[model samples]
Target: MGDNIRYKFDYLIDKGFYWSIGLRSSFSHFNKNITASLLLNDTEIDAMGLNKIGVELQDQTNQFYLQTLFRKDFALSIGAEHKRLEITSETLATNNVDEEFVFENTDYFSFYSNLKLDTYDDKYFPKNGVYFNGDLHWYLYASHFNKTFDAFSIAKADIGYAFSITDKLAVNLKSGGGFKLGDKTTQTLDFALGGYGNNLINNFVPFLGYDFISLTGNSYVKAYAGLDYNWLKKHHITLEANWANIDDDIFDTGEWFTLPDYRGYALGYAVDTFVGPIQVKYSYSPEQTKGFWYFTLGFWF
Candidate 1:
């Protein structure tokens, strides 16, 4: 049970420059990302496999940001955010490396900036081109019972490439990475390997693949490759695969069986269909919360 809202306004300055601002917020019941990781040593998963409900996932977030663009999609932005991660049921401390026996009602305040370099054939989806996006954020402060957050930096990037493998088939690849610069960072700020969503926490991906894999550590990287089968002149149905892993691992104390490292993969089937002039994605990933089906439309911001 969750909802998301985003608002954006842009003001054009002359004909060459414009300023844009955005506000976003989202809510979720049991940690926005009801991922397979939620199944770890889970006494609840035994009774409800992925159907685990009425658990501690309650969380909310809000972000406000502004940007300026001068030419050719080259833009920059600065923003601040507020996050509340309250997991009253479970402890995030794995293998006893952390002593926090419970996930607290931690509050975090962050400041971040973004850079977009769009050189692809299309902004949303590209057929034969490349695109790259970058982000740098600072964890200004936070209040957690067992955790401390000072000034720390996080940098992340996403790279995409699409090309023709054959007349009937096309290929697209994506790679993303996130790393922390400070020695101490919030658990929410740690780079996790699996589960969906982009740069922010509100955009969480639910459970599906590898029973548990959101291994948070110093750094994490993931890659995806998709092959499209052209059914129409300008459209194609795609089959994609992804893999991700973290640099550090969770040392097991043999307390209970769980994935000690964040390393997993997923296989996906998706098709791009059009609603008039817009693209709609009707897809299925055994790697998501609703393991059966999901769809992404152009207007779903």
Candidate 2:
């Protein structure tokens, strides 16, 4: 985690109307470091070779919008956003000289819309109903590295359903994906999948067994199936499986199933405490030699 400052203001049009106007702004910093043995075509070394890679990103964003009430069951919002982004990286590119750090700044203006619907019976432990969320972004102007771009778009969605099989058992299913269209998209703007928590501003999704933001691509589709057994009112046991395909050209090819790249399995136990839920999960993936353990005190802050 890094520095972050965010604020929002809302004005209601009328006491009984379900509409509001809002203004929001935020400034944040994010950093990531990676070390991996990557090869191109399974033969030659990748462009950055086999070295530690570091990235530091800073962003300032402001938005003005009108929206339906932020209700538990349904909501809609349309907004215009302006963003300033700066990125600095080391060992991410090679110049064949002493210079190892690279820096760039970009600015973007876009129109976006968001829709959400949720009918889950419970927030922490849902045993019935479904939920859906979708977003669309259309960029009207972008300036990066002294170059300009217009007419870029991004679309993303997530849907989930949960139901009880027996009084003590429940099942949950979820699927989500996204696409980035237009050329010269920045690295940090790509959809990232991995880890156990979400950073919505950066489009970071959680995959059980991988490192934080480890998988990156222009397009991806992922799904999860899980079962929960309530041993008692406050105790639960869970099992889950997830599969995903992440690629730069996923929609253009017929290799979706033939190249199912990432898969994970997990088993977990949870206790509903007075303060919050405590979760302990063990997860495994084919790419790892050992299983991973995750512990969380609450859902998210």
Candidate 3:
């Protein structure tokens, strides 16, 4: 079983000033394996054996922010966010076999601001501009079984630029790297993606870019490329193909579990074109070792 809860608030202080806040929580439970026994003609015999497992997961998040538009060409903003996650799992067996339990927790804090320049409509470059965005974040994560605790922190600064290639196309580029400030061994960075759309599609927009992370300390690089397309004025589709390969001896440290080696493609689609404000979505992830599929439906304002 799984459940999630979320909340958000937005306020307009004035024509040029605004504030927003959000929160989220989640939980999950499941079972893993089981077994049974029987006897025939007074002779004991193994009737059936099964593996059953269960999982319970939970998450919570909160955010608050304020922004002010100083002029037609400039703006300023600030925000803070908080997040938490908890997970638990259990396994059952027969013949008096012992059960297993696992737990993990994570918490994070973030503060960010941006000074943006507006260049949305210029005859020479109708959809282009430059901006400077910066952020500071702290994270704390622990695993009960491993008896390990990680307190990591990082600060980042990014320079973003956008240019229009034509009335139908535009490109954006951002390149910046962050430095680890706490008990960590690697540097983190911020990247950007580019998107394109046309008036006729009104609902269909497509984008492509690389979202990547490098762990030089662990000697591994992970990256994903994908596209998001909208349809039917209320439907959305996303396709992401990811790849990751180990390059160093760090895998021997058992930390390899934190790395994403799925190395496959995933498709996700959602639509809100139903009556009574209902929404539906589906997803599939096929892997070399194991695979899974999911579906969801809901209604909201």
In TM-score terms, which candidate is top?
2
- Predict model 2's lDDT versus the native: 0.73
TM-score of 3: 0.40
Q: After superposition, how far is residue 193 of candidate 1 from its true place, in Å?
A: 2.6
TM-scores, all candidates, are 0.63, 0.81, 0.40
Clashing pairs in 2: none
Q: What does candidate 2 score on TM? A: 0.81
Query: Which of the two candidates, 1 or 3, achieves a greater TM-score against the reference?
Result: 1
Candidate 1 positional error at 10, Å: 11
Q: Rank the candidates by TM-score, best first.
A: 2, 1, 3
Span of ten consecutive residues with least summed lDDT in model 3: 197-206
lDDT of 2 by residue, 1-301 (tens): 3264443344434322366777877766767663222102212235435443566767877888777846545688899999887766665556656554544577888999999888888766778999899989887777756363547688889999999999999998999988888863344566777777534465667888876666777778899988999989889999988888886758777445464689889999999888778999899999778777878886544
**Overall lDDT per candidate, in order of appearance:** 0.54, 0.73, 0.39
lDDT of 2 at 259: 48
Show the colliding residue pairs in model 1. 29-57, 29-58, 30-57, 31-57
Candidate number that wins on lDDT, 2 or 3: 2
Q: Which regions of candidate 1 deviate over 4 angstroms? A: 1-18, 31-55, 90-102, 119-125, 144-147, 166-168, 196-213, 232-236, 249-268, 273-300
Query: Which portions of model 3 miss their true places by more than 4 Å?
Result: 9-55, 69-77, 82-85, 91-135, 139-151, 154-181, 184-240, 244-262, 266-287, 296-301
Would you list the rank order by lDDT, best first? Answer: 2, 1, 3
lDDT at position 137, candidate 3? 55
